[model samples]
Target: MRTKPIRALATLAAMITISSTALLTGAADTHAADVHAEGTHAADIHTAAPPGLESLVDTAVTGYLKDDRIPGAAVTVVSGGKPVLTKGYGVADVRTRAPVDADRTGFFLGSLAKLFTAQSASQLVTEGRIDARADVNDHLREATVPDTRPGRPVTLDHLLTHTAGFDSDLVGRNKASAEDVEPLAEGLTTRRPPRVRAPGQVAAYDNYGYALAGQLVADVSGQDFPAYVDTRILRPLGMTHSTFAQPRPPRIAGQQARGYRPDGASGWTEAKGQYGSWSPAGPGAVSTAGDMGRWLTDQLTADSAANRLMRQVHYRQDPRLPGLGYGYEEWRRDGRTGWFKDGDIPGFHSTLLLLPAHDLGVFVVFNGDGTDGRAAVDGRNLIDRVVDHLVPARPATPEAPRPSADPALATYTGSYRAARVSRSSLMAVEGLVGAVTVEKDGDTGLRTTGLSVDPQHGEQRWTALGDGLFRERGAGGATLAFTGDGLLVSSATPATAYERLTWRQSPALHTALLGFGLAVAALGAIAYPATAAARHLRRRDPHPRAARAARAAAAVTGLLAVTFAASLAAVVSDANAMMEAVPLGSPLLTAVTVTGTALVVTTLGVATGAMAAWQRGWWNRTARVLFTLTALGCLALASMLLLYHLVTAPLTWITG
Candidate 1:
């Protein structure tokens, strides 16, 4: 109510933004790089090192197999455009205990497949068949991106860098089998996500954008995406172990490392039906660590125009911060910048890291997402460790930053949410939990909370470098800039940015409202019947008939509200299942909508009765006040639910 109508509309307009991994928005849960440190604390599974780099890598890989950390994993290390090590760890199948073969085992590549799509599009760009800066519709044969901004069309550049502004969607991202898949062009044309931001502005990791890139590659090259990638890219790189074919071409059909989900404390549930038709966005595409290593090695050497294009920095939110390449996300470690990409599906996780500074690259794929779903986190940690071990850095003293010339230090102090989060769906809830708070640290410094980043401490202090940009205080080389029309940009995550959140959209306020409402409703549920029973036992004067009706309405409102809350909880317990369930018109979603309707209706009745009780003098002033508070609590709870788009039947969040 406090928000002006015009500002509220603006907020709603801004709500069309994105999240990653459905990602914890997939929070880019389309992750760029796990900043677990360029020198990992744990990714280096071993403390002791052998004589050679290859031997050291082998020891680190074999460390994974020891603690039952992951059932299976594949690793490939390349330096100077040559394979330093290509190895497999643990078993491909826990049930059969099939030993993983690095060159033979095919593991699902999640969003890392975008690298291929980017490469394909890059090739077309090199051939002058597709324009990197032109509207993508110019090259598409079947799919067309809507002109959300009349002057700005989503170009091949936007799609590749995750800056196309498409909303992230997890719907249909995972399927039981390849047979359930839809055709690429059909899905692209029909299921295009709304362009929430202008093309070439802000990076939001989008699977749909990559799918469009793949379609663009297919359209211009006159070959299917898979076949083109197979003949033109994979085969040429000598990546014989890789294929984009769903159900995986017959050669690698039985070669897959079965994905697994932890069943309980120790058990494993073999994950099935995990592939989807978003071939270029990941899933359905398969590659071994050894093959993925070749892909990494190729990046270091730049064998073709496409590879070089893919490696070039195409976009940056802030020059002081890490920028994005074609499909590769820019990452920094020990002040050594490099290309990094991480991917995750249901039970599979992978990371491709290229430290071109040292001519080093690492590719890691896990059959299991680990018990905590941190396969990417662990793998990135592993990468940093290897790089740190092989590559030595002579630390340079950071130049003390001159104070920011920009006068408005207070302008940067506020709570912010990631731009990659959803605005129009239940996924908007991600915005609440992922809030990043920035507060003034000194005359020219800011201390950011909630990022939980920085290699040493989860928190970081930023000393101003003028122009609203700040660098980390000491050895940490991270940079933060207030750009994108005042959006917060960081060197750590190029694909994600942060925007200031207002009071009406404040997660703390909303959470407090819901908590208070739930608490009051639950208390009323207990107090109403108990009070009636006590009065009866005490033989007190019976309330008037209309008064009894009012009391009954209040009690029912409380019960229904609590019931709706419970139903909502059960439905959203697993984000992945909810993504699949919501689009299919989930039965639980139906129940929630039904329960919510009843709760809303009863809340209205309670509000009406509150008025009646005040007019009729049906109870003591204290009792009347209590009843009114209960009514307000129920209304607040319902309002909170409505704010999240939870009351609608067949609750769909995919693009709202």
Candidate 2:
């Protein structure tokens, strides 16, 4: 949490259920007739406009692009298997002054590519090439999944629903260039993330799981992942403008849009660092808004196995929690149930939502993260706007507190960190900074802080539903349930689960301990030099060697402590950059490693020196006491460094 922007997005996400599920159940022939009577594409707006909806979209988009400084964006909306609006906004390339074209400009679809991966696997299920319930390794030829859980192998269903329990791993998953991209299986086999949870136990957004799914599709189909998608999925769906290829195919290379970011002042800079080995996880896919529109319509109408899977909930943490269906995240917003898939890579961000109940869908993409990541916020806001206009949510009835406390409240009360964080590596630091606190607010009502806080209210209020379940105090909100195994899953964000954080892993304790140590270090750092100068001028020595040795050890400890803190600050300042891989070669990472090691070594020196001081009586009692505190502070600093695994030969934030 770098402060303001993250907090804002968190507020919006918690309130919007940006937070709830489905543009899909099935599309009937009647839907076509209904749309024909209403309208078709944006072109039909003048003849058969949906009143002021088009104008609202245009106004909202224009304001968002300008205010957010988004250089380029593409939006697609489908209603009843027809395009309601398919358009582009702003310039795709600022330097060329090139305007974006919905049918031509290809935008990266980050994690949204996971939808295609799910579809491909579902296709195999339809043909009996693979069983959805079988072990994922059953179909694999080149890449094999280790048996992390005996008798409960991860299935294709688990992969699609993000219930496979693969620990998150992004570092080095991407290559700097298309030429550097390796074969799918080879890339997946290397550095595969360890399974931290059993299959279907908890859901954590996993790029590696999709990568594995893509490899399975490839092995069974005897085609590359990209080729399999293009031939079987894209071409069949009339998504001719989309491809999972790294370098765009010659047919669409010239038509591709360049993703961008703000140049800080007013200009736009090309965003880079987005090529990877995993074609199925979304880093390799690119599509135009028009193509995405077609895909949306097809997803809502198609009678294929993938479509069938999309129509039903494959996984829900709680009965009231509308979780994941196939690869799409499910939600219930404004009395409209919808399924949405969002993608994000460097320079590109996209969201695709399908409301099966209404036979309507929306696809949004931006070339930039936007002013403080508002593109993501605005994307959800745009969906809300559309859903609100189309189907207004009935006013919520006021909720009252439950009369009695749930017997399971104690079991649910604890600090939790998202399951998406890597526990084995240095990346564990992320969980500490982003911990969620669940507290018993009243007799039976529980307040969740930092997990899913409502924007209007500071924290989310929930009335206990007994047996470890919680219903939102407000209407149009998510349901939360604590699993028997200490995992918290919500209907709002089904992509990930929160695992209980142990007391030692608590950031509150970390901050307090580190602050105390750093304070002592800071004082010692200045005092050592100042006092040394005084001692030299006085030209009086009563045990110069002993006093000097102890002072030197404390001084060295102080220096390393400062170095560790400064380096850590530099690393965490931009966490988005570290997602794919930690910058192993960065001087800052090296500084942390070196300083941490030195700090540990010097702490030993300080400890030895502290004892020597006591035994030899190096100074007056007051000076001796102060030095002891200094030694304890250095010891505390060392313990924290070790606790965070910062000195683990490899740094946590760095891929190295």
Candidate 3:
């Protein structure tokens, strides 16, 4: 699945929390405190600034990098269209012991590359080559996006705002070797995902939509996506250190930071970078802090129509949520309005935030995969800390009008799912297995549990803020409100909206159904084998034909159980292996499908035999009941497999 950037950052934050104490000790030893102290005296080294702001940022970044075991990072803070602090910290290459240089060390921008792609599209709009509100199909030269909802064509505005209804498609080939990547058009055609919602409706963050937008850029410009971006945006902005090329160019090879992941110990391991098929959507650009500084300056100071369009608030994801501009996620917090884009791949995390109100731009990137709970850094939080130091939090607002006690509040209780989830693939496991549970806490407040996948299971108490809106109590609290059809849980960005689900649509129900099916099928699979072995030892044979049918049923159920277990294990052990296995036509998935088919057929015979034995009184009531229930369990398993589209197709959980 194309993991949402917020979820990825949440995972990293959770990991950072695990080893904070020990990591902080290491950070102290790295003279991070001294760096903060030196920042006060070294104002002449950069530019004139507030006495403590630079020190605060230095302290924050060094501590984060050290505590997270992130090998290196580059940070740039732009004020008044000038970089006041552009610095690199720690080693870029562990074996070579190459120190990072802020101006030179290139970092993979990950999904932040979407900003550049959006800028390119804005340029097309400025040139009158494309219309933001027109149907996207109007610009396509190769494969057309199917209009899943007739009369509602997806527009460039939908793509820019991520309101495009395309389902998440993350199964395309991601090559560690650039040569293995196919053309953008070929990749999109091969892995085009089915649209799941009406265009211009619910905002689901679809990277594939950006891929289509890139294609549109190519179609109109008569140049490839990268070349157009280079000629139109990068060259104009003088961001010379950036390139939207996979494997990077030879000239900048040595300047690239070596990506790393935690080795499970207090050490790091090299993580090779990879390129996915939809590189243009994001995860294709590599650039230096210096280049990003230039880019941020352009965003703040440029007067071109394209730059103006890029900053326009094209879509409000939800009336209750923040608005999304052409390439930016806009939010109003602490009386300050800001726009930002977060990016993440396997071994890198990047974020760019622009507070135009404050004339402040913050860019940060880390070199770590953050898988082992040791090398995960939260760049967003770091930016927030720095911003807080520079621009103090706004004063509290006065109390609002008292909320009405709605008698219908109790009716709102139920499990809710995120709108941005994979419904057609195994990635749907995330949506189908976990859901946010909302229940009434009192007449004026509500309690929400299971809002995350973490085992700790954090719960929030929401007090009514009038109308249908509820505000979470305490610092950094979220706001929740109900739409006409569903609930919208507030997020840092509008892209991560939570969609309420009906009881019938709850993942809990599906989980319980699958759990019961697995439990009963397992009982039959084990009991029949044990019973047959005991009969053999006792020299007692039931009717030969019925006995054979029972044994066949047992064998098939056993195979089904084993196949399911193995597939689950493969996913848990190495998720990427399962992902790679999907496009290649996995043998394990085929085995599971074959066994499930046989179980479905064989269970019918078991049911028939059990019925015959019951009618003939060949077996006791206990044995007959057990056999019948077992057969029913087997049938239930088969039914579930079919219902969930797991039997005929590759198990999405295992493959995706």
Candidate 4:
């Protein structure tokens, strides 16, 4: 099995934030006004047509669906507080051949549900029920966020802006059914992730932080989190087709667009949807395009206290941009400001963008997970294309200071790790090996490698933008600035920051160490069988019992290596399949877990037998030394696996 990059659904949401920067690209001049056609939804309002908007949108969406082989999607565009276009493309149910209905179809909102949670929290603040800056623990009844830093309590503001400093943990939280889902308080307590940083100091996109916020909402509002959201936000906005319920409400239960994954050459396979115990933290919302349109419209035009509070800029992750404020991620360029939120889970992807300056909003939902080469149909990119068509970029402003070879630049040359990283599992290995290296480029420019996942094209050039800020040469409108606090900030996604690290803690060093260790283990495992066979052929066997024990150790060590390789292959080859299987229980997981346990036991046995052989002096020095080394190596390998959670018992409730 090839090692596939297995990302939890929570990680998928964080990835969306990184990818959203690409949405600002494309040529302008295509206006939504041109696509002025009323949708099937009775509430849709139409205005003057801009002539070519409809065709432009249709062409883009149709091409995306076909190219990516996505089964279905729904898009709603709102201009001047009215929905100008609401449309659905392709089948909602592949099995039933049901056509997607923009007004009726409910797609999982994924992390976008965080927007509602944020709104709920903000609403409480507006109603004087909760203070944005108050300690979150004051309102919690079921769980408590321990104070990692004295005098700095995790606040509603911190949670809203994703600066609560919680370490990322999704294991055993993404439950596939209501039965598996735990109550918000119990769930948070059970999977209570540690705060890795001081609250309000660093921005780390956290689903658990939002989950805590939901619990706060439930406690303060005296209503269930979902009920409060529905009554206060959804229903009040006339979003009747939307529900935050996990198993889904009866009214919209049958209307769900089944999530899908690519089935190799055989076409699409329906994916079992996931429900998290921290559903309110992110995920577990079902909504339609029409309902989303209404929600967007209210966001754009409503004067409600909660709506007003949601729009307020609370914390800016990037000093160069407006950054993340409250429930929405905000961006400003060329005098225009926009707020957006994106969501991604196993089988569903959604994005909501509101351009308050233009009084325009766009919502997109894809039923199929983009793992099947359909990532190009990104909701952010889709919205960006539409935005460009309607409100094109203004002329470029005067350039900032040119790059200069300042000797002081050496201070910036180092490795930086993403502020948000996987903790408490083997996934931490990724963070360990994924640091970005900044090196001085020709004269004035700097080159950054490993900032992106693409190893072949990882290097990005940056020219100084004054004030310790460096702007990417060809990033269009993106920028990266070095903060006084030894952090790197990106204008594109202000919700995430990167922390600079010392040489010893660099990703390059850790990656090299891991590679070297693995290589030695592989060589030893391979040489064991070859050496044994050669010895047997030569009839040189001595101390038969010890030899047999050595051979058994070698075989078990080889099996461990093979198991690790297979696990990685399973992840790389079909991550979605692996994700679906892990939460539901699968034979593959059983095999790997059982084999891993055996490897641990066998390794220990080898270590004990090798000690006995060394004490008894039953073999030649070379044979005893080799056996001792092999035993030690096996133990080390097993220990590494155990430390990384590789050999842990299979988790039936965790979904990637």
- As a whole number from 0 to 100, the lDDT of residue 75 in candidate 1 is 80
Off by over 4 Å in 4: 1-45, 147-150, 333-335, 371-373, 399-406, 432-434, 449-459, 523-526, 529-541, 544-551, 578-643, 649-656
Report the number of clashing residue pairs per model.
Answer: 27, 25, 2, 15
For residues 1-656, what per-residue lDDT tens digits would candidate 3 score against the true structure? 23332232232212112112111111112232322222211212256655676677778766766666566778888887687888787767665656677777888777888898899999889889899999989999875788668899989999888888887745334666566777889888988887888878777777888888888899988998888888887787787778886656787766888766554345555544346557667755788887898889888887889878887777765576677888788856666678978876656778888988788998988776444322223676778787887887787667643555766687778877777766665345456544578899889888887553223436887887666777777665456777767756465547656787767777666656666666777767677777778887998875666666765575567556556645544323423233333333355545545555565666677677777767777567887787777766666666555544455444443333
- The residue ranges of model 1 lying beyond 4 angstroms of the native Cα positions read 1-51, 62-68, 397-409, 442-444, 452-458, 473-476, 529-557, 564-624, 647-656
Best-to-worst TM-score order: 3, 4, 2, 1
Task: Assess every candidate by TM-score.
Answer: 0.82, 0.84, 0.85, 0.85
Error of 4 at 597 (Å): 6.0
Q: Which 10-residue window of candidate 3 scores lowest in summed lDDT? A: 18-27
Models ranked on lDDT: 2, 1, 4, 3
Candidate 1 per-residue lDDT over residues 1-656, each given as its tens digit: 00011011122212221111111111111111211111111222222332476566556655653333467787877776677677776677766667677888888887788888888888888988888888888888788887768998888888888888887545334567777778788877666667788877777767788888998899899998899999998999898878887667777878888876544445456555456666888768888877776677677877688777877888888777788898788888665778988876666778878887788888888887554444556676678778778877547656745657457777898888777675555445556555787988878789987664322234678888787888787764678889748689887778777878888888778777877777777778888878887888999956897777777887887777667665655555443334334433355656666776677667788888889988988799999999999988988877766665555534344225
Residues 1-656 of candidate 2 have per-residue lDDT tens digits of 11121222122112112112211112112221221222212322212335676787778877777777677677877886688777777766655556778888888888888888888888888888889889878789898888867887988888888889887655445665677787888888876877888888777777788889999899899998899999998998788889998776888767777765544345544555567788798776888898888888888887776688765788876565678887888877635678877777766778778888788888888877665555666777787787788767765456633545787676678788887776655455556556778988877879887765223344888888777878777656567888877888887777787889788878678767767887787678778877888888998656658678888888878877776766655544433322222412344555666888788888888788788889988888898899999999988877766665567454433332
Worst 10 residues of 1 by lDDT: 1-10
